[model samples]
Target: MTFFLPFSTVARLRFGSASRIHIFALYRWNY
Candidate 1:
């Protein structure tokens, strides 16, 4: 379980940044 902790944190950060980037692109596309 301890091993899963770091992996999950990294995954969450990556997904968070990816989603933000994706949202930025979509926002520009909409404009």
Candidate 2:
């Protein structure tokens, strides 16, 4: 479990950033 924990966290962070960027772009067009 210890070995897989860090990898999961990093993957979550990367995915979160990508999603955040997409959301930002989507919101930009709302104006």
Summed backbone clashes in each candidate are 0, 0
- Predicted structure 2, TM vs. truth: 0.64
Task: Give lDDT tens digits, candidate 1, residues 1-31.
Answer: 9999999999999999999999999999999
> For each candidate, what is the lDDT?
1.00, 0.96
Task: Output the number of the lDDT-best candidate.
Answer: 1
Off by over 4 Å in 1: none
Winning candidate number (TM-score) = 1
Writing each residue's lDDT as its tens digit, candidate 2 over 1-31 gives 9989999999999999999999999999896
Alpha-carbon deviation at 30 in model 1, angstroms: 0.8
Q: Lowest lDDT 10-mer window, candidate 1?
A: 1-10
Residue 5, candidate 2: how far off, in angstroms? Answer: 1.0
